[model samples]
Target: MWNIMKYVCAEGIVYRGLCGHRYADKRRSVRLWVGGPFTHQIHAVHNSVPFSQTHVVTSPPWRVLFFGTDSFAEESLKHLFASSCCRQKAGSAVVKLLEVVTLPKDLPVRRFALQNQLRVHDWPNVNVQDRFDVGVVVSFGCLLREDLICQFPYGILNIHPSLLPRWRGPAPVFHTVLHGDSVSGVTVMQIRPKRFDVGPILNQCIYPVPENATAEELGETLATMGAKLLIDTLQNLPECVANRREQPSNGVTSAPKISTSMSWIVWEEHTCDQIDRLFRAIGSRIPLRTLWMGEPIKLLDFVGKFHTSLSGAEAETPGTVRYDRESDSLLVSCKDGRVAFRAVMLKKRLSALDFYNGYLHPFFLKKLPRQQKKCVFGSYKTKESDTPLGREAAHKVQNV
Candidate 1:
């Protein structure tokens, strides 16, 4: 049995339309679906909105309202535009892209959308008209109001980075890397008003995290996967929405956004596996910051392997910086292990040993008159919260 969809007007009015013949608007034509893959234009209620131009026959593809302000959104939009639903059998555009609602500060997404001749809107509360059939949002920062979304017959769809109820929030991709999750996936689901990511799921696809894939690498993979998943779901929007399944709220987890304060690595606190995973999360930006010789040191690159005899440092001694001149590599101490590193951000992507000896050691080491035994490299702190980032600290949301 086909499911009946309802729509509410701007004036808090509720109305329902039958499956066959209806008038969309007096000024335009309404295309109503009689059965599978068949449609006809007829005069119906003035409230009904036309999906396509009335003069031409056949059901026009959905008029999609895109909400995204990042690369992820760009990928999905590209797929939709290149897909058959967006294009007609004759090579003409079947679906129309309404204005894109994006973040004010996101220039790249806006630029891409405008380049395709699509209108872009940046205000938080986008003034949504009733003409759109469906709204598609991916990586959009703001929350859409329920009143605005109610105007459409087909509800809004959101493409999320992680599986629902597992990593739900703004930073699923980041958390997936930080936590060393072997499995990562994309979720295409309906958006619940005000809530972050709790909604009924329409489709999902999972993939393994590569051996040492950074957050950016994993995100790139998911971006492509999610784009395809979203387009496929949209192609069968009616059935998918009718068969939608709610996300299990029992295992709900929040992947709060990342912050600078969460980048401090506590050398003694985290184990070798944890430290290596964090380096992967760093990807190509926001290298971990920690104190060395009472001065700040930035960790640019880290290797997955642990070094014991290579560093000549005893096991369990964390925060010891060692330089292997032969290999041109650097080792930083971690709990029960030493993690190999390549560079520090202050200098070029060269050996950290060079950075320490040439500049950091000369200026920073002299300040410490006495070389204390069992000294932790990251012990210096300007404030108490500067402490190393732990599992709890990593996920902790500050001032949201």
Candidate 2:
């Protein structure tokens, strides 16, 4: 999904194409969550709208409008129009707002076309005079035909969240979360016909995703970031029009549109680091795996990057339980060495100290000789006649 990048406290014209993502080559195989993956485009447009009281008429800041489906995008535009923030303080100065007209039902191939890209014949409310000074398209799911591009005095600019040419698809943020990339950014570019995310760059910004972000969270966060970038560029449109800088050709990577199959978690072929990245990038949309007893558990969160050599135990394998249930930390074995879990997810909820205490089985207790009390979490007070097992799991850890 595209997020609009903007400059606060600046004047400019910005157009919004609240379009959804439609597959260029394989429509039958693609699927996505509505208002996600590609829905951030709408969010970028909605949030970046100037909340000032400027009179937006002829020769005003810059004229902007939206075109989209009758469903989500159209309704979203209506909500924006109704917002008090968009209205000027003086009732006399109305911003040049336009009602979203639905796509035409009369045109051939109307059903297959993106709601915004249907032939004008397909637009029931097509007015030949519906022209604009500039266009900013965030999550338009349809391909913009040449006629639409020619309608604007300035070309249409799009907000793509990935650093263009890589992850150039409908779900860059989703893929970034799933893949666990350390950095993901937003891009603003010219909307070239038929080419997806290959336009000349206007501007781009990248941000870091920590090891715990889920897909839903990353998508919303990126949308907010991207929208700001778009608005900032719009404020400086005069400079951009005077001097259009061509995008560099070197680091291009395409994020192809994703599907439900792409969302499935692969337990094998995934390193702990790889798995960690995917979970953070995808966010909560993709669940993490854990087993309680014999049933699989959906983990809300867990700690990774464990060190086996730190355990000081030659006999313990990676993921092996140095389970200290009393302290709420589990020493699980990793591929290379042993790592400890101070916290874990049992269902959707995260367990602090008591969670680990509840899972303590007697067999898990027999594995350690009771000397591994590193104070993971909880009360530091020790009983006078403490056994080896009690000592190991009784130390206190600061809850972070």
Candidate 3:
């Protein structure tokens, strides 16, 4: 839905269109028309003022320039394009003109703009001559300079996936899940030059994080919510700008980008819950890693904590691996509890059954009788100074 504010004359003359249509009478009262997807006719009335001698006035549609790159940014661009199309069909569009700015690569937003036949401008190479009413940036990566920001009448608006003053960086969604935040949300804020996610907030909405939600799931939810919120913000752009407030100083935090080094799992140092959270946060992009028999292995299909018992489980220390025939899983002990995985990968991926038959069964048969410690998984040494022992070097391990 979109709103068009109009000034009403004392003679009850209504300004019929969005493009500054005016009557000769003096301005006295205002009428706000709430419009549907394809219709501009008034469906509801709000903030009605008493009519007197008033000149009729109207706000023109906006010329928007949007900047984006990833799937998260594509959602907002789609909404803006749809709204522009709807308004155009109704003879008065909320967005008068819409163009896109993206990197040269075939990113999500760039592909979308090309498919829709929207004018596309490559980043740092924009050639727009006419001034735009407003600019929008979402997951664009680059820090916009002050000279570029001065091109828009209303500056730029950003649709961020996290509430400002918290997780204020590129990997907010990842950190939110990694840190096990129970609540998360989206923020629509004005953009500032030479920095990121530090502008005054125009709008914000809270969304409750579902239990055991992965970063991908949380990101998908926030993307849709942010898109809808972006449209709503544009609908009330003037009022939003007038009423915008600076973000609170308190509760500030930073969310740095995810790194490959974070994927390594240290069985002796991390709890079951910590490892589970790490998998949910970044396992989709980077598999959870561990060292097996001094060789790197990737853990897959994480099945959370294991509850069933093995006959000699209590005797085995953390990083000791056991195959559960009943569940067809590989169970590894952590600092607090055990976690299960359905498959593991060294050179090629293998199911738990295959790994046990090919690698573990023979080794365990040879080592279990003698109660040798070499059969257990060990932490990979990431630094030159790190010791080869699993427990001693666990804290210093990095991605293998």
- Highest lDDT: give the candidate number: 3
Residue 193 in model 2: lDDT: 81
Better candidate number, 1 or 2, judged by TM-score: 1
Tell me each candidate's TM-score.
Answer: 0.77, 0.53, 0.80
lDDT of 3 by residue, 29-83 (tens): 4544323222334233444444432222234467889999999999999889888
Q: Which prediction has the highest TM-score against the true structure? A: 3
Backbone collisions counted per model: 4, 55, 5
C-alpha RMSD by candidate, in order: 7.8, 16.8, 8.6
Q: Candidates 1 and 2: which is better by lDDT?
A: 1
Q: What is the lDDT of residue 192 in candidate 3?
A: 80
Per-residue alpha-carbon lDDT of candidate 2 for residues 1-400, written as tens digits (9 for 90 to 100): 2322222122433222223212211111112212321232212122222232221122334455544442223333333333312454544222244333335543212332334342323333434344545655666566777666655544677777787766776778777776667888888777878877776677778888765777667676767676666656665764543344455677655566654233322322345666566556543554544333323334444566554345465554333455544445555544444334455555445454445554455544456457532222221223523312243332211110
Per-residue lDDT over 1-400 for candidate 1, one digit per residue giving the tens place of the 0 to 100 score: 1222333234333333322223244333333342222332333345445453222212336677888888878898777676534355653443555568787774667988778777777767577656677788889888888776655556688999898889888999989999988898999887778787887788889888888788999999999999989877876776776567778758787899787666666776778788777878864667777665444567766665554465356554577776667656566777767777678754345466776576445465566556543235564333536545333332332311
Q: For model 3, where is the 10-residue window of minimal lDDT?
A: 16-25
Deviation in angstroms for 99 in model 1? 3.0
Global local distance difference test of model 2: 0.48
